[model samples]
Target chain A: MSDKSTLFKFDNISVTVEGKQVVNSVSLNIKRGEVHAIMGPNGSGKSSLSNALMGHPAYNITNGQAALDGVDILGMAADERSRAGLFLAFQYPLAIPGVTVANFMRTALQAHRGKDADMADFRKLFKKKMADLSIDPTFATRYLNDGFSGGEKKRIEILQLSVLDPKMAILDETDSGLDIDALKEVSKGINEYRNNNNAVLMVTHYQRLLNYVKPDFVHVMMDGRLVTSGGPELALKLEDQGYEWVEKEFGQKAEA
Target chain B: MNIVTDSKYMIPHQSPALERGPAWLREKRRASQTEFNELPLPRRGLHLWRYTDPSGFMAIPDSADETAPSENYKLVEKLELDHLKSGNLEALVTDFGGRDIKVSRSGDDVTKGLVISSLSEAANSHAELIEKHLYSLIGGSSGKFEAMNSALWNDGIFIYVPDNVEVKKPLHLLREAGVEGSIQYPRLLVVVGKNASLTIVDEYGGGSSDFRNGQSYSNAVVEIIAEQDSRLRYISLQRQASGMQSYLTHRAQAQAGASILTIPLVFGAAISKQNFGVLLDGKGADSKMYGLLFGTSRQHLDNHTLHHHRAGMTTSDIDFKVVLRDKAMSAYTGLIRIEEDAKTCEAYQENRNLLLSDSTRAQTVPELEILNEDVSCSHGATAGPIDPMQIFQLQSRGIHEADAVRMIVSGYVQSSLKLVPEDLRERISEFVAHRLEDI
Candidate 1:
């Protein structure tokens, strides 16, 4: 590999939840700059794959390999994995009762850049990111996710994505609970972050968000396995033909 | 398994030092000494002592007199902010174990016929006024600690606001205690005159602006006389050293059309138990009591309040919240008593406690005795640990677990601390934040 080359790979990884396997042998690879969309129905293991990769306690990775640039991250804690350039925008972020969003953001960034993180710089950067994302400045003072609208939560998630920039980002179901307007705003934030050295893997139930942030590749996952892989045309095809054709033709074979 | 008989128990000796006050006060002290000697140490049989046994307090430390004033003579101003109008009636007394009693009052109210004097000097200057109200309401037949205070208390503070005169600025009392093995019986007697209003902020701690660091035993008696048609707010803050032990009694009698609000913040002391009671003595008298307690370390704190609605159409509302961490423990028992003739009264009581550690614990019991069916009364109590989900959410954002817990505790307590008047909120918040740091 060249010095400039960057890669995040999940080579034949399996995840189990409560002794029942959820994500079965899956292999995927993304270099420094690429976008991949995992489109699947409910209970297709798409969410499990992202959670297992991020070290969520509920999802246990039972087999095979998962790594960042050939360095195994399967053994790393969630925070360690994050510090090593892995980021997951949770589908349902917990509501922290007393912590303000500004403080939470500062502390998270500090964990990576040392505790004495430049406060003035953080304020300046935060001001610009919040403005760019069209978030009200007052929202920074609110407790994290406490009484926030579904749309507001997704917006904050994108705001976090922009500020806590990582080498590769896994956005799990970022479009699931958002309205059309919120989905557009979320896609706008994701669209602004694409580069050759930064990858994005989006797990979604529909292709609504795909229309805004175009993906380089689209993979169909069914019953814990990636049944078929193809280009952006596959997303358009599934959007139009409704995933039934893919389930009938390839889901069973992939399961076997 | 050794218990001292009444004949062998320690009491104030009849030395000249103890006989320096008014002859009546001196005689009262001599009599109360016998009473303290005759009474046994508080056992677990009393409902108020269920959470603790005072018999463990084996020996009352002989008063260790301060040989010299701390070179630092500057007033420890915890509430003297530029924003506070309270500096108008300022009083500073440190080295409390010393033999000096002088209240350095700003005296704007004194010029308006207000009287704030040293209780020791009351024997000469305002002997009649002090004799009329001092020790008349709270501790005559109270208990061992009350009798001890009545018998041994050497210094006194007397605050008397003249009739129909409203001293808009607060009267500040800085009660800082130091000197190891010293037993201090500090007394504060407040008599707000008819139709007059006054505010008193009483601060208790180790004289310097530091948290618990000294070892002392203090028994304090606070008697407040809310004269007819008067309004008063008594805010007491305890920031004593962890080595200090305090057993206190606070009683307020509200006369007709009078109102009183008592706010007590309990933060310090190794073992502290307060018996706070209020009497609505006349028609239309009102009492609003709110308290906050934050205990950490191995501290044991017990607080009990009694709301005696003695007259018709009188009202009382009591609310208290406590936050505990480490091995700290707190127990609160509150009661609302509406006598048969006290009809058409309203009463509400609630106690909420947040326990932050596995070993930290709290017990709250809210009780009511209503003799009139026309009275409206309600009471509730709850204790619980910090929400783990709240902790996980903060950790997921990369904050350390300890910081997260501190934030939650602060939020829980800050909401109740907000009930304090605006002028005192900043200082109260600073004190709370500083205490949270130790946890």
Candidate 2:
């Protein structure tokens, strides 16, 4: 099969965080130009799946094989994985105090484009991206995520998503803590970053974000496993019905 | 009982610099010489001497005299000269191991009543101001090393801004020590008059390159006075060469309605012990100190800061940050003391240390002494390795591990670096970056 058919795929991925398995042998494939949404209740391992895939130090992938463009990524370091065309938008983006957003982005871009990246070009691109996200120009100089509101932090995450421009982006709970207006702006950033050559896998608890950025596939996670998979309508059903029915049908009890 | 009777560390009775000054000045030097001879090396049990060994800074008996400035010192001298010619600085003073002192003014018509001359020259020209304020804050009785500097300094820098005169640009002092096995005493005395304002950058560089072959010793003393309603900003940048043992004592007093800002940036030297203190002597006086130190390799750095509120309604704040990597070690002790009569005063002190490697060691002690009932005082200290989560967040963005560490460290010092002047800030940033390059 052509690599384009499976831009990002993980098979039998089992993750144990701190010696307790959080994601159990979950398997999925996402093709280029597709957006896959993982909808689940809290503690259902949706975030863990994305974190393990991104090579978080605390998350141990016991038995899994992840690949981007047909290259194994399980053995790579977090930074190497990122350089190999994978990205993770953290649910709670850590605040790097005293580091300006412009400075952080410029350094990240340099890492991706090698040290020869023109700084003048970076400034221009950063200004345009900040404008595109409706972020105030002043934020370019503001410390990265420091003292930012919840919605502002989420917006900055998506800003990184667009600026880094990876082939496969795994966004963990990018829609949480954001008001409707902020949710709309974040979704707009995700949509803008999505194209025929890139794919997105968003782990979200709510179906509201999917309304703005339509997904080609939606998966239901229960007890650290993908219990069911379907099209966009599945997310709407899950939103309307909640995860109680999925738990009952899959015979997997949610942790108390 | 541990009196250091070594004559090598004692000042000679007929030192040329002491002979050139007035009789009163010569008497003060003689007294300092006696103090140095009688004072003992600080005991290891003492709080200030617990981490650093005082013997390392002792004068080497057969050390060489003044040598030509290193190539790096020459480069920095040219840079400061350029800054002077371009009007970025009010004046530039270069002192080579306290032997030769040169002063260059900006040439532009700047503020009036501004005096910049060698300390010996000022002892004769501006004797009234120099004699009255010099040694008032730091003197023979301050400490053993302080007394050594007081008696042995061959030449020093003296700056004075008269009442209501404001120097628009910074005055830069480039104090360079000698090469291997050399012992030099560098002194500075600054007085800012009532309602006047001045900024000074005192930078130290050039010294021995290895201790096994031979080591150099530098003992420096700085005393500052900010009169009523005046403003003073002093930045002390120490980037000496390896294999140098350096000791520095700096003290300043701010009068009523005056404010003093002190920034100490330390990066080089094999072993360094620096003490900085500010006394709020009058009511409504204010003082703020921001210090940053970055140590690498096997360097040892020990620093102390004091904010003393002696008058009612005075205020003070201190933020000292230290970053250590490799096998380097740093010990920071800060104290905020409010006197009994200093009622309704407010003081805050914080010392944060970032250890970049498991092998690096850091010690932080933040102390407060509030003798009044109607005051607010708080002190905090924290020493730990960088947050792995922050590093992971940066690394997940594709930055190499070393570059990520560098970026995080640069950010940690960004706040203090913001307080420095533009050119110096860039130079300090370069120093910090160089320290973290191999991380």
Candidate 3:
């Protein structure tokens, strides 16, 4: 805590979606230059926590005090929070049928940076970023995530993360539905984007992604609550023994 | 609302405008004059006139007086002339209120059997060709407005592409209207000969800006014939001012083995009603129509499209899209018909409307008539607001809500815009952007 200050902090954040409490008073603090993973089973409220943090319309944050870099973001709009250095890589990215990737990126960048924020060279910068992610240059002209393969969609999300370069990045199941090679490529982009001035919080189901991008802390989310907290070894233990042990040892089992 | 009771716009038998053409052309005009006086005004609750009132398009006493051009028409003229000089366009024609037609041709291709001239001039030089094809597709019997234009049209445009001639660049026709209380009748006749190809951008710009106090009127008719094995791309761009009431009818016929592409990019006028139809007359002919319209403010827009398969083994497809915001209203009706003898024909039609605001209204009616069992026909109609999920996705990426909505609306019409030329595509995109500014 002395070496690295808190970049993102949420205190007792509860989310209610469609008249049902999904995330129950979840409290977490992510420090700069660190990576944290929240491992959980299918209906454990991991994605709900991430979505509520990003201000998804359907997921209402009933009670919470969320801040980014000591600035209150609970009352800010999604775009305001994004401009305030917060990024969320959606697990299922929506397809904008006729919007090209380059156009979308430029618009988003203009909103974050000033409208007159002159990139030294926009085309060259975009080309280099696409090359870094091993994505084809043709994808720049193609519609954003429209008709893209699963791997391609995930890679584009990381591409956004790298381009936006936010202070706190919450990747909601970024590793889901990705093959080993795609997962590696995505991990490479995420790792490249990580530095001492930023933080990463990954919501994931399996521990396979932890092997690629090592996390400093691991927490188990169950029944809309953070039941246990531990080190990276806890992820391996959860992978080996599954969430059954954590349910019996920590609290009651989650409803199916 | 009865046009027969409107005496100011009634055409006299000895009107000077109708007497300029040749003897045969004069006879046709005289017949159309009689038809115009006899035909009644379109009634409300009719098939295509349900949502729009016909009285807006009728000419008043002031509409007969000559007036000056809108201020923007000069700038637009210079821009088009620049396109001609830069080789972006094959030819440029400026028709001022359909009373004056000026033609400017460029490149060696135009000199070789590519005829672009005023209709009056062509009627004398190419009498047989003019008499045979003129008004054959759209004439007095088409509608009340058609008869009015046929009888009252002044000097107009006539384009003829000879056999085996291929014009690489687009031919631009700048139809400029006058200011408040001004009326114009614009006519266009294009014939593509056997195995030839041509592309035309018929752009309509200018009109009054005072809708309630001093409204202008414009009635237009277009007839196109794509001969055997020929190719034709006709792009109609309507971007007039807000205080204009415009009516237009466009029809084309595609011959055997020929293909026709019709694009109607409509984005202007206080009350605009346009009808576009194509007839597949010969076997194996194909026709496709892609249209886009964006309405803002309290504008009223009505559009209709038709694809008739008259011969066997023909194919046709129509995709018309509408985007409305504010208190704007739009009604789109598309019909696809396959004749009993037109076996193995394939026809498809789709009309989608996006309502950007809660007060905006949109109505889509897609009709299909298949008389033969061997044909394949399908029609779809959809009217809804923009998807909130799409907006959220854009907002999460740091795009503000308004910018996100603009981007989505622009993207919605991008597909149809792609089918046009680069210059027209850019112009249409700018129009779309301008309409979304106040939203």
Candidate 4:
């Protein structure tokens, strides 16, 4: 509950979907002004953890507590959670036809801010953010995520993150579908938003993203549990030795 | 006194004042009355009435005087009618009293010899032209409503465009309904000379909504003749008051190298049936018919269209869209018939419906009868609900379920509105939005 250190605390959290436990009891703390990366193999519940944090209806919180700045977010609706400064960059962005990206973004911003922003000021700020992310101006008029390439869609997610400026952002595999060039651009955008007042949870299966964003803490999740937590060296170790070494070490520890 | 009643005698006779009309015209109206009396009322057995019931309209009184215009009404406003040019004719506004009908010209290009005026006025001013064209295009035995319209119509519009003149702006006509039980018989006769061009937008909106048992009947007839190398764009927008019954009949004939475009938007009326017929009488003529209707509550809208290609090398395309919400119902039947000698013709027809609720119903039938070889023709119909995945996508972004549905419906209808002019697009969008609010 102390604001002097941790920005978000997930205590003894367990989530279930369709009677199958996906994210088991796990406790983690993300400190203010730091980047934390959760790296693991596929089906390690990384995405489930992110979705549960964002209050997605599909990911049921069986027995756990997720709080933002000491306020319980377990009972908040998705929009309410969003208004409370929670953001999620989905692994697959949905396509909404007939709704321009610019219009949708502005409406989201207004809804989150709880007031109508001046049109002139909003446009200027939006244009600046888009330029910083290297997004083309013509994208504003295009339909939301409609007919966008994989790389373009990823960049658009980053674009929204920059524009919304949420208190805490959960990027779910933003680097999964991106090429090298797109990954570099996305990393730059994410790094630019890293400040002393906000925190970020990057969920990925590889160490490529941590190489650029420079995570302050690296946690390895296996079978719905955070087996090891350490400094940046942990990410490099996992990338070099793969998940087999972690699985063996855990097996040995269990036997002992 | 037995107090006996007969449907035939229930209708009032056209005053002897029209006795001055040419003998040929008088005989035509009399013969039309006979046809109106003999033709059977549309029944549920008919394919055209599959999704709608006509029993409610059968009880309407045949007496036109019972719903005659009252003297208390005044011309609300005079719409700008100057957009019509010579050779290209537009619509006419007739007051309920059968006394005044205003006709305006939109453009200044008058070519050859053209005449545009009120029907009653034309009967007195240009009797020769009226005698030659009026009722000639509208067959006396077409249907019962056509016959009734011919016998009861008091004042209407008459347009004659000379050869080779093109009118730019669309001519607009406004028909105002006065008190309850107000019967309006609007007759329009348009004649396009050889090599002429014109565009007409006939709009009917303005009347009190408190007329529950008004038994209003709008028997309208439109006759168009397109000469060689001529083009005509005719648009009819009918938004009648609730609980009103409307029977409209429109017919057009296109000559060689002529093109005709007709678009109709029907929004109101308790039970309404519109019959539109386009005849390609000349080779190489083209016709396009487009329609959109929105029915809510217990309203019933029946639309029947016929595209007759009587000449060789003619083409026609028809597209109709309907949206039904609540307990409302809509029926659309389109027919494309090609004559034996109409070789190398092309025809296409499509009808699509969107049902917004479980109670709403829509019936669509697209028929094609081709008797000529080396011709291409196709017809299709579709009816269903909105896509659910699209809805979830919008909901995931924080938009409410209801607003998401509205956006989808708006987008579905916008496909047709894209063909309309830019100035009219926003107006139509607002109108559609307002209609959805009631749903």
Candidate 5:
């Protein structure tokens, strides 16, 4: 899930939820300067894979390894996973009352980088990032995710991505609840970040974000497994023709 | 806890310092000393000291440690006075060991006729003002220690602002203790005239942070009087020493159309028992009392507050918060009294505590006695550990657990911090934040 070097490799990583195999024997290797997207229907284990990679307690890895470069990361805690260059943009970020966004980001940036942010420097960067995401600067002092709209929360998650600049980021349904303007803005931030040779694992149920970020590799997961893998055209085809066609080919009915 | 009053611990009032004071004060001192010897010490029978243990006062130092004076008084000298040349501060009083060091800033229009002088000097020069307010809160016979302070107190400060005069800047009273084992009674008497507004900050600190090792007990009594249509902000900053066990009482009376704010920041003392009492007597009078305490190590702190609403249409709000760690313990007991005539009054009280470690603990009790049927009053209290999810959220961002705890504690206390005036809020916030870093 994370390591010193910027390489994300998941090999036969099987995950189970309450004794049921949600992510069965998933294997993928993502390196710097690459964009990978996973598009799957509900119950296809798209979110489970992301959560397992980030070491969520609900997801148990029965076998295989998720390594960053040569270092194994399955043993690390969720926080340690974050420190080791693995960032998971949650579909629903936790609302932390009484803690401001600026304070949270300051501490996060200090941890990611080895020094505290100077007041002027932090304000400048915060203002710039907020501007780039079309977020009101006043959001800096608001409680972290408390009472934030869906679009606002998604933008804040992307805001964090732009600021922390993690070596590898997993965008889990970031584009689900956003309007067109917000989707374009979030995708723009992602595109600018991938230009720095950083990697991203985009897990989505729609082909909407791929139209903006344009993943280099597309994956169609079904029955807790990737039934098909292709280039950018795969996402367009899935958008035109729903998962019913894929289920017929894979011999498994979709969950909904 | 119970202990019989020991005759051998009686203080003799015939010292040279007593001789320097006026003869009437000397006679009063001797009489109070005798009262101290006869009054029974607080036991379970006394309700005020119920939660407090009397055994802590059983053994007393053989004699009071004699103090010369404070020579290092540069804190006021280095003040950025240029920014506040014309605001308020009717008088400036600086005393070390009850001796008047120097008084200045009284020649301007705002300071004319303002009375600021040493307690001993006022006992003779301003006899009427001193005698009127002296022991007004303690009632001259509350307890053995209070009676002893009334009789043995060497020097203190007296502040009086005349009618219609508003001191814009805050008056400063600095009480610095140098000796390790000295017994000192620091007293302050304030009377704000009608239609006058004033802010007084009384800061008590050690002469040196590297205080010598020894046991000392200090009892500080403060009384304030606010006349009609006046405003007062009183702050007590007690940062004495780790070896000191202290009792501080801040009692005030608010007249009609008066507004008063009292905030006490306690960051020092091994064991401290503090009392804040306010009496709202006039219609339309308002009072806000907030206390913030941060305890580390084995410090023991007990805080009690009293709000007496004697008139209708009065309003009062109270909040007290404490953060404890490392076996430190604190208890907060508050009382709000609303009599029959106090109809239509509004009263609110809240106490919150955060325990940073398993060994530390806090107890909060909010008691109300309301005799009026048409009044609004409520109270709430909470004491618990920080949320683990909050900690994990901060930690996931790479913050150390210790820093995360500090942040949570700081945020928990900040709810009460926002209720105070703007002047001391930032300074006290920084002090609390700094204390949390190493706790």
Candidate 6:
């Protein structure tokens, strides 16, 4: 287990879905001021891990514990987890019709501040943030994620990240369906949130994202377990050799 | 036959047609009074009144005192009648008893060949047209209130658009109900001649804010006869006091190649029932009926609609939406009937209700009766509260509890409002916003 003072720590966390274990005995640590990438194949429990840490009701944490800044998060509700400075950029954002982005953003900003955000200042800040991402001003008047294109939806998720400014963000497959240009824009948005004092956990199946947003640590996940943890070199190695080499090594470890 | 013996006031005695109307119309009202006296009141077992109680009808006071006009009632805007002919249509704004009913007209170009006047004045002038179309659509009978309206309606609007002419701007009529235990029987007879087009708006609102002792009943009947190739757009705005009860019966018949669209918005009333019927009597005719209702704080809104397709190759579409909150209840029963000989007819009915609170209630019954094998018809109904996942997503973004709900509800009702005309869309949106304020 990582030290309690660490920004985020997952100690032997196990989660179950429909009476079956999907994420088993996984331990991970996200230190303050560092970007860690978790790369895994499909159905390897990547999303389950993120959802469990965020306390999604469907992903029950059967055992172990997750904490933010030494405060336990296992029993907290999803909203409480968010209030505690944890955020998840979903792979597929839900559409909320009739809810304009401006109104939704303001309400969220107020919730994070535990008070109402002054309309004047909030407007100014929102425009600035929107400008930073090169988003059209009229987009703010549209319903949240309703009838939005795939890339546009991704941009909206990042837009929230820019406004809410949570301490640690889990980007769950944020690069799944983006082309090179959209990938570059999304990476730029994520990089804006990157600083020396805040951490980001980027969960993806490809190393293309790592190229744009460099990470200090890269971990390989297979069959719900972390098989390897290395520097940025690990991502390059996996790209060169494919996941077959890691699968073979896991088999040997189990035999031993 | 003295029909007034059962009630405090005699029906034929209070009818304006009995005194001032032509002898033929006077005799018609007398016969209608006899028929109303003979017909039994609707009982609880009738399917038409399943969700409605008969007590509201039986509790009518012996006589509605005539109210003198007061300055409290205001006309936001006056519609013009210059383009209409001198003696074809009548416009009357009636108060309870004392004050004279005000009538104002705007716009220029009054040289056209259409009659425009008050119903009371029309009774003396165009008595023949009034006698022909008045009470003709009711046929045998409807129910108690409808029969009563046919027997004793005093003030109303009579519009007749001549053939081959198109009215540019929509005609607006405002009826304001005031005082408690008062009964206002408002009637409208719209006649569109062959190849003519017209749009009319009927706006109803209460003059008083008090609901309890200020209880009032408005039994309004709107009958439209669209000749071949004619087009008519009719919109009704029903805004009553909170504790008042309102009953409305609207019927329209579309002839060959003619079209009719009716949009209704119901916002207020302790208990309200609206019966809408659209009959396609000519081949290739079409009808579109759209309605929206917002009920909150113990309001009960019941809407019944029927699309009777008696002509082949005719089409009809009906979409009704309701939003209920704070223990408000809503019931919707819609039917699309295709007659045996009405082959190749097409009909669609859809009803959707959004319940904002657990205490709120909604019941939807959409049915279709088709006897023609070559016809195409379908109906759908859905009732559910807000989606939890949707709420969670909005909450994750930091939206407040109330705003999130507003967003969900506004989205649910926006689709129905889109079918209304541009001039009335903003008014409907504002009305919905006011209904959602307390919740």
Docking class of 3: high
Instruction: Choose 1 or 5, whichever is better by DockQ.
Output: 5
For model 6, what is the error of residue B34's alpha carbon versus the real structure, in angstroms, after optimal superposition?
2.8
Query: What interface root-mean-square deviation (Å) does model 4 yield?
Result: 3.2
lDDT of each residue in A9-71, candidate 3, tens digit only: 999999999999999999999999999999999889999999888878888999979999999
Model 1 interface RMSD over true interface Cα atoms: 2.8
- Please tell me the TM-score of chain A for candidate 5: 0.92
Cα-based TM-score, every candidate: 0.78, 0.96, 0.96, 0.77, 0.80, 0.82
All DockQ scores: 0.27, 0.84, 0.81, 0.22, 0.34, 0.38
Best by DockQ: 2
| DockQ, 0 to 1 scale, candidate 4 | 0.22
Provide the lowest-lDDT 10-residue window in model 1 chain B. Answer: B1-10
- Compose the digit string of candidate 4's lDDT tens values, residues B1-439: 0112233342435544234355766776667666766777656676766765544443233333433333322332332332232333333344443335765443444333557678877887878878877887675576656666676566788877878776654555666554455556677888887888777766664433544544455657788878887988887777777756676788899889999988878887777888888999888999998888888888889999999999999999988889889898888999899989998999999998989999988888877788877789989999988766565444444555576677777766765665564444565778789988854
Model 2 lDDT tens row, B188-272: 9999999999999999999887766667778899999999999999999999998788899999999999999999999989999
lDDT of 1 by residue, B23-134 (tens): 8888788777777778877768766889976764444444354432233323354335332335544344332542345565553434477787778876689889888998
In CAPRI terms, model 4 is classed as incorrect
User: What lDDT is reached at residue B385 by model 4?
Assistant: 84
In the range A1-256, model 4's lDDT, one tens digit per residue, is 4444877888989988888888889888887888898988898888888888777767888998988877888888666677677788888887776567887777667665555545556788889998998999999988778899999999998888888887788899999988999999999999998888889989999999988999989888888888888989999998899999988876223242
lDDT by residue for model 5 over B340-430, one digit each (tens)? Answer: 9888999999888878889997878788899989999999998888766667656656666787777777666665666454555676778
Which regions of candidate 2 deviate over 4 angstroms? A1-4, A117-120, A254-256, B1-20, B60-64
lDDT of 3 by residue, B109-200 (tens): 45478899999899999888899999898877787789888888887899999999998899999998887777889999999999999999
Question: What is the alpha-carbon lDDT of model 4 when measured against the actual structure?
Answer: 0.74
Candidates sorted by lDDT, descending order?
Answer: 3, 2, 1, 5, 6, 4
Worst 10 residues of 4 chain B by lDDT: B1-10
DockQ value of candidate 2:
0.84
Tens-digit lDDT string for candidate 6 (B399-427): 54565677678766776677565656776
TM-score of 2: 0.96
